[model samples]
Target: MSVHELAVTESVIAAISMQLPDSQVAVVHLEIGRLSGVMPDAVRFCFELAGEGTCVEGARLDITEPEGTGSCASCGTSFPARDALAVCPCGSADVTISGGAELTIKAVEVTDDV
Candidate 1:
């Protein structure tokens, strides 16, 4: 999973480079979820390896941990969850995940050419 994510990130950076031919990316903001099955440490490690000799090489990576959210159908209540165990305070097993399973690039910082 980590290898795949690094490959995907590299692809995204390449796409961005095409749009900003004169500028270089300096940083990338990533949103990582606990349930996304991605470890932050592993991603950071793999990013360095994957970015070798690329335009995104040596770019700073900023990661955000998004908490999981779930909604209860019994009492129409929504609350934050920490993990896959989504038991509502109202004791409702009928819950749907609303967030925290996403891995995405939120923003990219680019350096203007001289």
Candidate 2:
């Protein structure tokens, strides 16, 4: 896995640990967009390593990848944006990517403290 993913995972664990210091994390819900530049697989691979000895250890890593969306400025058309440079149906290159490119932690599930 990339070091970037490891850093991201560490940050995630740090945030969760800070939020629910007394609880046992059961799951980590993540939303990784296609344009986000963060790989879901890399995060998954690094989760366990990052969460070692932390509350998030052994926690389930839930990731969701949202497809990128773009809007055409010339024709006012909205379409899927698989890449940064997207073309519009009207043969216009003036497209604005609206959605995707998000790496969010939607929710965190925790188990009851013993």
Among these predictions, the greatest TM-score belongs to 2
lDDT per residue as tens, model 1, 1-114? 467677666666677667765666788788888777777777877777777666667889899989899999999999997777788999988888889988888888877752
Q: TM-scores of the models, in the given order?
A: 0.81, 0.93
In candidate 1, stretches whose alpha carbon ends up further than 4 angstroms from where it belongs are 1-22
Q: List the residue pairs that clash in candidate 2.
A: 36-101
TM-score of 2: 0.93
**Candidate with best lDDT:** 2
List per-prediction Cα lDDT, in the order shown. 0.78, 0.90
The C-alpha RMSD of each candidate to the native structure, in angstroms, is 2.4, 1.1
Worst 10 residues of 1 by lDDT: 1-10
Quote the positional error of residue 97 for candidate 2 in Å. 1.3
